[model samples]
Target chain A: MTSSKDTEHPLFQRIEGVRQRTGRVRDPIVTQAHGGGGKAMRDLIDDVICGALGMSAQQIQEDQARFSLAALAQYGDRLAFTTDAYVVSPLFFPGGDIGKLAVNGTINDLAVSGAIPLYLSCSLIIEEGLPMETLRAVLQSMGEAARAASVHFVTGDTKVVPRGAADQLFVTTTGIGVIPQGLEIAAHQLQPNDAILINGYLGDHGAAILVARGELQLETTIESDCAALHGLIAALHDAGITIRAMRDITRGGLSAVLNELAQASQVHIAVDGTKLPIRPEVQGFCEILGFDPIHLANEGKLALAVPSEQIEQALKVMHAHPLGQQAAHIATCRPTPAGLVTLDTGFGGERILEMLVGEQLPRIC
Target chain B: MRFVSEFRDPATGKKVLQQIEQQLRQLGHDASHPLKIMEVCGGHTHTIFKFGLEGMLPPSIELVHGPGCPVCVLPVGRLDDAIAIASQPDVIFTTFGDTLRVPGSQKSLLQCKAEGADIRTVYSPTDALSLARQHPQKKVVFFGIGFETTAPATALTLLQAREEAVSNFSVFCNHITIIPTLEAILADPSLRIDGFLGPGHVTMVIGLEPYTFVCDVHKKPFVISGFEPLDVLQSLVMLLEQFRQGRCFVENQYKRLVQPQGNRVAQQAMQTVFEAREHFEWRGLGSIPHSGLRLREAFSAFDAEKHFAIPAQQVADPKACQCGDVLKGAIKPWQCKVFGTACTPETPIGACMVSSEGACAAYYNYGRLSTSRKLEATR
Candidate 1:
């Protein structure tokens, strides 16, 4: 049997200790006092991620580790910074929770930007009176995930609000990394003839969380694809291929990101709908739930804009990394009215991609 | 998946789009006088908007959204009824999320909830039964809403409630029928509808026969369509062809799901559960005779109205709101003075702006920007 844990990223080791602070089980829900600075924050951090994942005291205290951030540097520069917030509902989901999501999300953002994640600062707002155990479990997961990624626990801030003032627990994370020398990535770097590549299937992460929450009934079990991607980034950078802009497909999913990139670069991206690597289960869930996969969220996934010639080299490197094993070339760039993403659908008609508005699956991270 | 995937197929979609475009051009329509068709189903409106269907169709073919959303068409009196039941200290009200935002005579159910009333938005009707079982001390009233498509679930729920002998469970049934509303729309002079894109799911329940009322009375072509891009494009083409030939008839293109008589088992369940009320007031259409359903006398114990002393009074819509005209397909949402200003989705003044399936809501979400874009592209 293949254990899924073996493919863990190196950044995980660095951030394990900091995550140990929030995992504690007290009452059923989170409390605003947990977010308050000082002992309260410490209690929350210990109760949630730290308590849930069960980190050692030594790992919790030292909070220092190194990751490969050199490859992501642009124009001889070395630092890359990224940040994101989690506002998912039913805080605890099937495969993961906001705690795991926060760490993985921040790391993924930095990874895709060609940076090797090194450290993170998490800020949390807890509704007053939230149970100690839920906070502990969240912290535990954060520590486990941080250890898996080998990212260091640097610093964090916490705040607490009155009951009902906060939605259980809300986490904001800022991740910093050192980009490797000579690699400059920007959306404008996407050329008309570049190929569009995806790390894996679309909509898995979104649908998994949705199904786990029972928002939409499906026959299969789908779990959130929340994981740190810095390892895969390292592998790709070593493979020595020119990569343009890369982005983690999160809220608004592939459609939102593609449209944003197209608009920014003044290029048209025509993705063959059939070429999309969506799981049958995800597709079924989307159809029954009346949602579009292109607009669904994916945590441990990204799209790469690279010259057509470098596609093979990128694929070889990506395949060696567990996170990028299922990666596929989904589409190619074309010269059209800039700022347009068109799908030549499976049925042979074209539809212009629009940014998804409102939450597709509420409470789905 | 069967109904959804087939319609989304690119090849099928292209065929339908090509056929619709060819038919539109063959009609030699004058660009000066564009063809306007109003889809009467809220579900249809949602599908149209979600896929940006308006952007796909030719400029000459303009889809004017209708007030087909049940939540959008729920009169203020119905909300008043729900609120009165929920506000009762002994009662816990349950409804779909859309209905919670519908303004009652005084305030919405959400406001009532904020004021300490027990109100919950349930994902399915089955959950209400669990609520009834859990809260045996309090009255549980499920705010039963939706057109024919959702009626079966409500019917089944009522039957289950009785079989389980759940005394605390009762239903505030606000279920409406489709045919009478269509008849009312035909009689209205304000709506100059050339044709209608019939509702697919409701037709799946009531079948294609009832829509004959639309064809015979209104002298307009009625096409039952599935909720897919291809299904919509095909229906549009069929309606265009009917108009060009000066023919009016009820046609069904959603053959896979909808039948002439619909599912007999579901209909039998409904027949056993409900009977028509003499007159029911619709939010935008006013009181249409024999248009609403009440729980049958056999199930009187399960009816909240029979057990509770809730007041039922006619409530007037806001004077500045033209949702009535919009629901009747008589006027466009933009024609209403308060449409974009006072009656936007954020602060919706009428039912049409609240429901996800509401015609106005659909336009606000998918059509507005696309329409503006089309105008700019043409210019």
Candidate 2:
């Protein structure tokens, strides 16, 4: 072990040597040699992953990260763990890339369950012939997103396959979080007369991806609403608002989340179409294509059910944050004979909103 | 959204609704014996159900959904041909999005696609032509189906392919005209329709001149109406006024997009590429003479039917479906025995329950609850 005061340790010198050797390849492209589990693989990881993540020599050499029991016991008594895989086409989009989506998506899975996200593990599967610069950029974005969410990438793995074995890139992120001692939130805790609220506008992520594919040939300035919601969620907790249930609106959009909640609690949910916070451009796109915006996907939006009296305080706290500017009260829960969802149209009629039978837009995430 | 929003204003719709009510009252029409007006366009049926226009109007004015939806009227045999073509290894089959789910005798295009078929959804026929240009080694077949509103675009696409010398592109033409279908509905002895709201987009292609027969022979008022809440309401008012004065005439209420002379260039393109078929099979209406179009002899090289051996035999509709009675306005959608029981949007047993614009689907999705409530009150 090197002393804490020693600035010129052999480990630091070896890391510096690996960095210098990687700098020699001016126009670097990944090849079979880099994935052979030999010196070439070490150099690629040292130059791209370690360099972008700014990992210490000891942390990089270790096989796994060990967390202390005392440190975890400070937050709560239970641990929340989740894992998600992201395979979005057109690796780069208007507001984010696959790396940021992987990070935020994992974090949101834990945060919506009333857990404070603490650690993440990132794994990458790269196709041979991808540029080294592209790998570096994605790693840098992941590091930046982790930093913004106050989480750490304690462990990771990388593998490269031959060309045509996979797409350009695919990422899988697993997250660990701790639920506070007093918080008990779940989808089944929803009660009748509870208020349903959303964080912001819907369908931005789905619409942005559709335009980014260049297949629709539509011109719009809509950007993906890919964001981490821990800050907004923590604020609501700090304000002493009692939340019964919460869910992130992701792949199946607001409709899927509400349906799941309604079935779980055995309550009926009725949402007003006029109250849904949808941008005009997104609505216009759906109108032209004969799609329903309710069935479209969203990334940063969340659906929360709380007591009717606390809705005002929840709205006030959410509006104070940057991510929740378009927060709205969308629906109310009722105790009907059957668990179903009804949408009161902006016109004076009502209809039942059901889960989509088939894929409305394929490869949306 | 400028033109769209103005036509859906609630205030404008209410005023027109009041005028329609007054005309009905002056003509002595009551709820016990209602006036049935058939809207001959699927687009109009969608607007009516989507906006809840049925509940807003008086019970005396009943809007009967007609057989104007091109997707709803497509026969089972034609869909079977599409599935067979799409299943071929070297062929790239393309069609509109809605046609992918219409059931055939065996499977739909969507089901074939799941089994490793190269089926794609395109917004226009030109997209299929471009696919042909991109892949010269593969054959691209476009399933051209719709009313007259969509026939011209397919015709123009075929002409463009010929001009560019794109040999891999072919069209499976199933385009149908609206006039003969309307004539078939009028000639049915079981139908008791009082007036007709003509299709708007079809009128934009072939103008109001073709609709004079509805008034001349059947002595029924026909109004070429737009597909909007206010436009439908205003057209109803005009039809009621005509009934009150005992005047049978064809009128125009969608002047914003449609003109008296129609689009001549589109008509010329359609005429150059297509000719009337001797007889065509409709899903609910049986076989009608001169109701469908086929590629002309000069354009046979670009016809998919000529290049491929398709099973062109007629397959009857499902046994328990009353789609014929529903299309001809002889019965309400709920009156059908299989309606909400054996037929639904998720598991459609009939063509009328497959498309969103179809009468059965629109009612099942939006109007079923209100209709059941009315049924309960009467019982």
Candidate 3:
């Protein structure tokens, strides 16, 4: 017993050290010193992502002692897996950051999959020689988000690289959660008579990111709705309604996601632009931006599909939840010719929602 | 919404369409004397495409997209200037995202960004102020690009920058006034354009007086139209009526939004901040006198030109590209040798193909898709 335990302790420390060094040197913007694999890599991790995030000593430890399977035992069966990368130009923004975005994004991926998020595996690739205090702040924010979502960080991998190989810092989080018993949801499972519903307005996240990065010049204040949606999903499931399909409106916003679903299910999605609740400030912003709100990204929102008959029930339950209070029935399922997301314009014309050909704006494209 | 929605009523739009149709029939469908009319603004082009106005118009009333969309017309040399400024160690370049994809002397702003340049896309002029305040040590140059509609905001920003005395902030002004460009197109004998669809916002600022050139010198009809879908249709109807009556004058279809004299305070601010450059380069039409603005000498400190020594360089247009003919309304987009072949939207070789407001882009987005149905229709 003494021989095995003692051998494993040092082995764990060595593995942890390797993981830390790797995260620093493999950063998108790498530097010569990061490749040196000496003090530079440690400094990179300590300064950029980990330092700003301010993780506890336990979290910083490079071992599996901090994790437990019981933490994710809430949902007994089917597991949901999702991962996302955060590469916003500006490291910080109004109302949130990469840390918060990483946490919320992982949780939403599971939530919209009809799963109760259980645990997350965080991976960070940070640039070399960034400030220590900035890294600490980011870590603290990530820890707060994890705690708020009631999810545990069970495992993680870190990599670092030389300067100029990456942006300031990028965090990739892969989440695994368990789907509740008896819950069956699939994109192709959507029936022709299914109704389309949205939690709230679109384009807030994309617009906020634009404003935060100082890319757009407009006379409006907009903020990203970067939030975890586990609470809202729980409320919806408890309302005793069967869901056909669900998805979070992310990168391509509502339109891209809707187009994907419509193509998958071989049915039509007709969105009512007028009924879709849009913030006046966001709308005013879109007018000058030449950006449609529907094609913008929404972080703290979800679109759900349910039978037309169950729409009233689903809407009532969504209304009861704070996150879903602004939820609206945006469209109905129509027998469209196999595949298309048609938008019924305010002027009584129908426009096809074409798949995004290129990045909406090329700076990020 | 209040000022924009009322003009798009279907019932009224139908009436205007009917009136134009009747007038066009009276003019007779003569190919040699086609009633060619050019909507001389990018905003109009966008409206024309969005509403499928070309398909709705009479056969004789040929609607040509004019030299509008400043982003589309911004030459590669100026883009290179912006790229040079953006690549500077202590300079942050702010521009619209549309400008980033535009090629500049073998490089684009997006490509520069990929090379670690501090290029940011902004939606409004004020956003540059924040970047300036945040990066005090770095020079923040707002690559000001747009037509007169956007000039007021850019002017206000320069005014604000001067008042604040933000040493690190400057504007690389590319704002081209619309009047001379219109004049250049109208004076050209080859165009033979019957009437002009005047710009609404430019009219809002400089007022209807500036467009008197069409009536006085060019002797062509000018109808100032709002940007809405129905407003464009109404303007066409008005132009056709003027043609039927053998009248050459300026009419206003966007009376609610535009006035004879625009916002005086805004114009006064622009006058204080900027002055007309003796001559400015247009992408397709070459150099036009008094078409562009430079910051007044008094506001030189806030002008990027005062700090940087980048020389303005003239670049030759790509050979066989017919952007000049297109801008002059002498040829349609389809007539260009590279219109949809070597110069498709994915690989745009000219400004007209790049900008969303560009005539080529409008044609590609709205009309090109249905080309097979109208293969033999367009001249």
Point to the candidate with the largest lDDT: 2
lDDT for each residue of candidate 2 in B1-379, tens digit (9 for 90 to 100): 7777788776777678778888888888888778999999998898888777786777777899999989999999999988877887799998888888889988888889999999988888988998999999999999999998899999999999989889999999999999999989998999999999989999999998999999999999999999778899888988988898889998999999899878899899999999999999999889999999999999999999998888886899999999988999888999999999989887888889988888998888767766765667657
Q: Which ten residues in a row have the lowest lDDT in candidate 2 chain B?
A: B369-378
i-RMS, every candidate? Answer: 6.1, 5.9, 5.7
**What lDDT does each candidate get?**
0.77, 0.87, 0.77
Error of 3 at A183 (Å): 6.2
lDDT string, candidate 1, B130-226, tens digits = 8889889988888888788788898999899889889999888988888888787777767777788988888888887777867886678889988
Candidate 1 C-alpha lDDT tens digits along A237-271: 77787889888898889998898889888998888
Output the lDDT of residue A57, model 3. Answer: 41
lDDT of 2 by residue, A180-293 (tens): 998988999888899999999999999999889886778999889999999999999999999899999998788889999999999999988889999989888877776777
Least well predicted 10-residue stretch by lDDT in candidate 1 chain B: B361-370
Give model 2's TM-score versus the native structure: 0.91
Q: Candidate 3: TM-score?
A: 0.75
For each candidate in turn, the TM-score is 0.77, 0.91, 0.75
